[model samples]
Target: MTVILERDCVIAGGGPAGMVLGYLLARSGLRVSVLEKHADFFRDFRGDTVHPSTVTVLRELGLRDRFLQLPVNRLRTLDLVVDDHRLRLVDFSTLPAPETFLVLAPQWDFLNFLGAEGAAFEGFDLRMNTDATGLIIEGDVVRGLRATGPDGDLEIRATLTVAADGRASTLRDAAGLVPEELGVPIDVLWFGLPKPTDPPPPTIAYASPRGMVITIDRGDRYQSGMVVKKGGLDALKQEGLPALRKHISDSATVLATVVEALTDWDQIKLLSVQINRLEKWHRPGFIAIGDAAHAMSPVFGVGVNYAVQDAVALSNAIAGDLAAGTAPEATLAAVQARRMGPVRKMQRVQRFAHGRLARATAGQHLAPRWAIGLLRASLPVTRRFLTRFIGLGFLPEHVDRPVR
Candidate 1:
């Protein structure tokens, strides 16, 4: 049986972009529906770094106090271990007070918090376990979406359709909107390690002769990741689990004992990194946001924050049209135009980082010897610039007015 529904806006994928946009639109009194393929937001090892810009957005939405209630680990500074030298790359403390640190929490907790908060609005409807299968297009213009859930087939008619279904978005494919692949040369193998009792410095990355391992403190355990060449997982499997563990141990000697927990291959999850963006992000009655528009590399952990920013920008740009039950045809281009600059700038940074990592993985020094000295000499100036760049981003989006 087909269950038909209508709304001012229909969003496919209840990710950061979709949820935030839906929440803002509904809070503004616009009827909005968000579809989530999963039954719940319990997925692990997703992007969990909530930057200051996102915190500011939460504050603007009047969710500051509630957001602080969630279990979170604060990272004020990011340390890097390059061979025998320790470098302080980023210092968030230099940013505005109170929100000067990065919050590390489980992605699900953050999503659930947003979901619960969004539910209070009467116009918000989040349909879980609903998978968007295709677009409902009419004469080159999208009408809504076709989806499947526990009940049966579903058809949604809306003034506007948004594809936030991630990098591998079905709706994006359905709309024939392909993202231009911005080449990335490295992937990451994520695993868990026992946290030290004494607690070491908040060192986020370690680069040794063996390889690079990124460590994120999760209170009880460390969510660790080992960087490798792109499409290199097969080669890693050939080297065996012990070799992989050895590489991780050699990269960060402090985690040598705890690396034993990864005795089975199943424990390590591979993150195939991709950096891409669409030449265009919208059709007549449809649009795409977040990873659907651009897939970010896990360089500075800015993907989630950027997605949230996109949502905020979209909400600020077209909430009036959506509230009036009109398709935001003209405003769709404006949204893309407003966001493309930041996306392009960040992607350039990611590409540069990838180049450095690729060279490092091939046994080349991550940076020149003299360059390291220069970085050390300019540490103070560098941290300040990086703080604003990473924390607030190129152009931080703010809530225009009280949505409620």
Candidate 2:
């Protein structure tokens, strides 16, 4: 039997975008329902960094201090090491007070935090173990969604339906939103090795002729990723685990002994990173945010944070309309208009950096002397630019509607 539910807004996918919007809009006193395909927030290989953009939102909501109690780490500087040369690329410490560094909390911790906060609001309704199957449309003006949960099928009708089901969004597909793929050449083979007993660097990457292996300090373990050619995971696997182990060990010598811990191939997750954005983020009563609207590359780990920013923009644009139960298509359009420029600029930079990585991985030698020299000479200028871009983002959102 299909369960019928009604709300002002129905959000598919309880990810950063969906959960944030659900929480904030409900805080604004709008009825919101967030559906998650999974039963629990725990997931593997999820984006773990909370960029300052989201941190600012938490501060605005007065949730930052409480949220800080969760298991978290700080990444103040991102260093790129090529052969014997090391360059500090993006430094988060340069950011202003109270938001100087990126918070490296697991995505589940972040999601659960959002879920709990949303639950505190009387207008918020969160349903887990629910998979959105298709959009509920009435004569081309979209209305809500039909989902399958543990209990049974659920039909939710709302003033606005948001597709946050990620890059392969069923709602986006059902809505016929086409994406422009920006052909990224790299795929990531992500796995974890034991964190070195000694103090580890905040975030470090070892780029060699074989490829690039980045290791982020995940408290007790080193969350590692090996960047290989697109569709290269299979070929790399065919070479066997020993070959994979050697590559990782070479990239991170401190983990040479630990690399043997990965005995089986299944432990390594192949992330086919795709960077794309929809030509249209909304059609009528439906809106798409986060990965559904624009799938980002893992180049800079900006996925979750960007999604958070999108939620803020989206909530700001349509909260009142949602409350009044008359969310017009124009308000949906405004969210996209306000956020697309930043997405385009970010993707352009990601694509350029992607090409550079591919070239560097295929060939030997570090970045050119002139390039390195330029980076060194312009450290201060570049530092401020990148710190702002990654930390606060292009257009940071504030809590327009805070619950009294």
Candidate 3:
């Protein structure tokens, strides 16, 4: 059976970006509906580190105190380690206002929290387990979306449609949008380890043979990730667990001391992180945000944070335009223009960082006898290099100043 629903905005994919956008738009008195394919938010091992820039935005939205109260770990500094040498990057302790640091929390929990808060708003509607299948277009503008809900196929008409779906976004594909590849060659092996009784410093360790090991602390556990060349996991697995253990042990002292063998291989996940930017972010009344618009490599871990920022920017821009009685198409185009520069800059940085790491040769080997020694020697320079890549030194002026 076919049903029809209408709203001011229809946001597909109830991830961080979509949920936050819904919350903001609903708060502004616009009828907003968020369609999520999942029955609930219980995914695992997503981007968990909420950076300082994101925290600043959350505070501006009045969600910081409640967000901090959740089960999350506070990360003040990012320690960069290469064969034992370490450099502390962006000391949040030194940053002004709420101490700019990465707040650690599961992505699903955060999304759930935002969704519930959005529900309290007067015009917010959440439809879980409903999948958007296609677009509803009239002339050059997108009039709404065609979706499949529990009842059956339905048509949802909205003034604007937002695609916040992840990397393999169906909406983007359906809209005939293709991403421009930046050619990132690294693939990552991710796994969660038991929360350490006494966690080591928050660090990223790079080794000669084992590639890069990124360690993030969950409130009660630790999540570790290793990046290797594309199609590297098969070769690593062929080397077996003993070889893997030895490789990690040799590369990072912290991991060597803390990591234990888990009987289940299912505990480990492998992801291919790609860096790409869409040719265009909007068409008529429809727009794309988050991974759908620009998917960045995991090197800097700013993907989710940037997505949330996009949501904030889009919501504020559109809300302002609506209040002024501007045309929806004109408003969306303006928002895209405002956001395109920052998104492009971030993609460029990701491409550069991924290239450097992927193309590193033995000639560039900076490892010293002591792992800490190598880190100390390389980290200062690396910290400076990373400041730009991590969306710190070059934050967009519009993002730095909220539209209040």
- lDDT agreement with native, every candidate: 0.89, 0.86, 0.74
16-72: candidate 2 lDDT, tens digit per residue: 999998998898888899999999999889898788888888988889888889999
Could you tell me which 10 consecutive residues in candidate 1 have the lowest summed lDDT? 321-330
Taking the tens digit of each residue's C-alpha lDDT, what string does model 3 give over 1-404?
Answer: 79988788888999888988898888888888999988988988788777777777777767788998898888777776654455686456555566356788889878888987888898999999999999998888888899998889989888888999878887888777898877767787788766456666776545444456667767566677766778888887898767766665566656665566544557678888888878788887788998989886776778787788788778877875644534377666776677678778777767776765664322234343574465456766765565444634345323323435
Kindly report which residue stretches of model 2 are placed more than 4 angstroms away from their true locations once superposed.
402-404
The top-ranked prediction according to TM-score is 1
Regarding lDDT, does 1 or 3 come out ahead?
1
Q: Give the TM-score of candidate 1.
A: 0.98
Ranking by TM-score: 1, 2, 3
RMSD over all Cα atoms, model 1: 1.3
